[model samples]
Target: MTVDSGIQWRVGDALEPITLPPVTRLELIQYAGASGDFNPIHTIDAEAEKAGLPGVIAHGMLTMAKISRLFSPYLKYGWVRDFYTRFVGKVFVDDVIMIGASVAEKEEKGAETVYWFEVIAQNRKEEHVAVGELTFLV
Candidate 1:
C-alpha cells in the first residue's frame, strides 16, 4: 500500500477477517488488573452466573481493542476520527471472536477523504458480540 500522495485510493474493498484469541478466565483477570475495571461480572464466576452470564466475562473494551487492532494496517498512523459501537451480546470464556470490516462508502468533500466503515465481531456460532462504525480521515 502507498500513502501520502495527493489522492489516496481505496486500499481494499474489504478487509481480511480478524479472529481473536479465545476468551479465557485468566485473560479476564489480567485485563481487570491492567485496565482497573474490576467489575464482578468480569472477575467473579459466581457473580457472573448469578447475573445470567455463563462465567466471569471479558470486559467489553478488551474485545473492542481486539477489533480495533484488526484495522491498524489500513489506518496506519492516523487515529480514527469517529468510532462507536453497539454491544449486541455477551462473550463468555472460551468463545472465539471473528472480526470483519467492509467499506460502506468513501467521500471526498475536499482535501481530506472520509472512509465510512462497518465492523462486527461474532462468535463461532455466528452470534454477534459487538457491531459498529468507524470513520477514518485519509
Candidate 2:
C-alpha cells in the first residue's frame, strides 16, 4: 500500500505482511532482560516443561512489538490513538510469525481523519497468536 503525504485514505487498505525471523532462546532471554520480565516460562526450557509448556515461549509483548512494527510507516504520518491485542496462543522459540493489518473503517472527524485497523498475527501453522485493533488519527 502506498502511504504519502496528503494521500487519500480508504477502507480495506492493507499493509504488507511482515514475516519475522524464527524466535530463539537467546532472543527470549534478551527480551526478558530488557523488559524486566524474567518469567521462567519465557526463558528457561526446564521451567517451561515443568509448567507443562512444550518449550520456552516468547514474551507476549515481544510478539506485540513484532506485530506493531507493521504500523511503522503509518505512524510516520499519523499518530496511534489506541492499540490493543488479545494474546490468543503461545509463540514458542523457533516459531516463525507473520503480522498483517487491514484498514477496517475510516471516517472524517472534524479536521482529522480517523482510521480503524484490524491487526492479526499468526504462526507457521496458521494459528492466531494475537488478534487486535489499532486506531489512528491522521
Candidate 3:
C-alpha cells in the first residue's frame, strides 16, 4: 500500500509465504521495460553465459520486487522505511522461487516503531537466491 498507513504489525507476526511463478526471459524483459534496468545480462542469453552465468538471468531488482510483494500483503497498509538486500545467487528462467519473511526484532525509536525483518527467497532446489532485511515504521 501507501507509506501513510497505520501500524497493525507486531514483533512476532509471520507473513504467509509466496511462491513466485517460474521465472522467464519474457518476464525479465517485461520488468526491464517497466523499470528501465535493461542490463544485457538480463536480456541477452549469450552475454549472460559468456559472463559465466547459466543463461539469461532475472534482474536482482525484479527478484526484490517479488520479495516486496510478499511483504506488502502481510504488513498491510505499510510504512517501509528502509529495505536492505543482497543477491546471493542468480535465478534463471524456469526456476521456482518462494518468498518468506518474519519479524527479526522490534524497537521503539521515540514516536516511531521499527520492525526489523528477515526475508529470504529460495529456489526449487531450496537454495537461497536472495536474502534481505527490511525496517518498517509502524
Q: Pick the candidate with the highest lDDT.
A: 2
Error of 1 at 117 (Å): 0.5
- The window of 10 residues in a row where model 3 has the poorest summed lDDT is 70-79
Among residues 3 or more apart in sequence or in different chains, the pairs in candidate 3 whose N, CA or C atoms overlap within 3 Å are none
Q: Against the hidden true structure, what lDDT does model 2 obtain?
A: 0.88
In model 2, the clashing pairs are: none
Candidate 1 segments whose C-alpha is farther than 4 A from its true place: 1-12, 75-77
> Per-prediction TM-score, please?
0.86, 0.92, 0.85
41: Cα error in model 1, Å: 0.6
RMSD of each: 2.9, 3.0, 3.7
True lDDT of residue 52, candidate 1: 87
Q: For residues 1-138, what per-residue lDDT tens digits would candidate 1 score against the true structure?
A: 886544343645677897878888898999889999989999898999899877787788988877787668756545578878888888888999999877888888776788877888899999999999888777
User: Cα deviation in Å at residue 107, candidate 1?
Assistant: 0.7
Q: What tens digits encode model 2's per-residue C-alpha lDDT throughout 1-138?
A: 995566466899888899998999999989899999988999888999999998888888998888778877767677888999999999988899999988999999898998998999999999999999988888
How far in Å is the alpha carbon of 48 misplaced in model 2? 0.5
TM-score, model 3 to reference: 0.85
Task: Flag regions of model 3 displaced more than 4 Å.
Answer: 1-10, 74-76, 109-111
For model 1, where is the 10-residue window of minimal lDDT? 4-13
